[model samples]
Target: MYYPGQEAQLRAAMAESEAFRQQIEANHARGPAEPSAAPAGSTADSSSGASGGVQTQECPRCHGSGQCNGCEGTGHKDVTDAVSGQMGEKKYSSEMCRTCGGSGKCQLCGGKGRTLPIW
Candidate 1:
């Protein structure tokens, strides 16, 4: 099934991209920093199973939104079967997201969108 507020989500996503662009620009304005500025034992990569000194890290599996990537949080998947109908016909249907079991959440994070520090 189509999730409610998809249009709103799209708008929000656009706004978020704008905000992210602004953030990048702001970071650029700060200019370059010394390599030693970063603390030891910390890393910039968030998806490397390391928390980089933070108490918790955003779940890499869902990108911190707690949404199922397989279905984009709609909890449904549109499937087309090529040989399910009359000659050369295709059948289309929607089904629950197998990755999330219809709950629309990331299996790794359990809808919290965060995980304990791996470091």
Candidate 2:
């Protein structure tokens, strides 16, 4: 047995899910890239290199995950209520970890939290 509007809702949900999956796939395709190295003869410190060097550390704000913290990496924050089609304050519920994509690892360090020397 099916309801009149149920099918439409189901289809909409499916479409939204597919769209989200595609977006996630596209994002994951980019993958994690190695940080660029500093110019030759640069005297950057052993820890936290200079501006020339690539950002070896993950973003504290996004945790190198490149997703919003308030939204739990969903990018879209929840709204408690709507007024005349207007949105309210942003909110969020539990979701997969953006840093490791729920793997619970540091993407920059690949969960190692540190990079190995080129040598």
Candidate 3:
């Protein structure tokens, strides 16, 4: 038989653990919902191949802005570069482009500035 107090403590601990698990699951399910507009050098599209592959556009997460704060409109936080070890301002601007958001696209042709015949 278990002690009365011991059972209560165990139950409380289990409840706390479950709550934490749910929080983590919820976080993982939600992801950034924007396009990143950082320079091409800072990003890459590995899935895109020669013939056919996933098209890589700006990171919607950053909205092409490289700072993390949505209010600030930047996709990165203010921190020293790991490699350079230098202090610098990292941020993204929303003034990029209303249409392509700085990607320079008509959306109809994926920024090609031209549309193909739908034949």
By TM-score, is 1 or 3 better?
1
TM-score, prediction 3? 0.26
Q: List the residue pairs that clash in candidate 1.
A: none
Q: How close is candidate 2 to the true structure, as a TM-score?
A: 0.27
How many residue-pair clashes does candidate 1 contain?
A: 0
lDDT of each: 0.69, 0.50, 0.44
Clashing residue pairs in candidate 2 are: none
Stretches > 4 Å off in candidate 3: 1-4, 33-119
lDDT of 2 by residue, 15-94 (tens): 99999999877765764343344433222234544233332433344444554444444534344555556566555445
Compute the lDDT of residue 20 as modeled in candidate 2: 100
Q: How far off is residue 81 in model 1, in Å? A: 11
Q: What is the alpha-carbon lDDT of model 2 when measured against the actual structure?
A: 0.50
Q: TM-score for each prediction?
A: 0.42, 0.27, 0.26
Highest-TM-score candidate:
1
lDDT by residue (tens digit), candidate 1, 16-89:
99999999787656644654664443335455553332345677789789988887677787465656566544
- Candidate 1 differs from the real structure by a C-alpha RMSD in angstroms, to one decimal, of 18.0
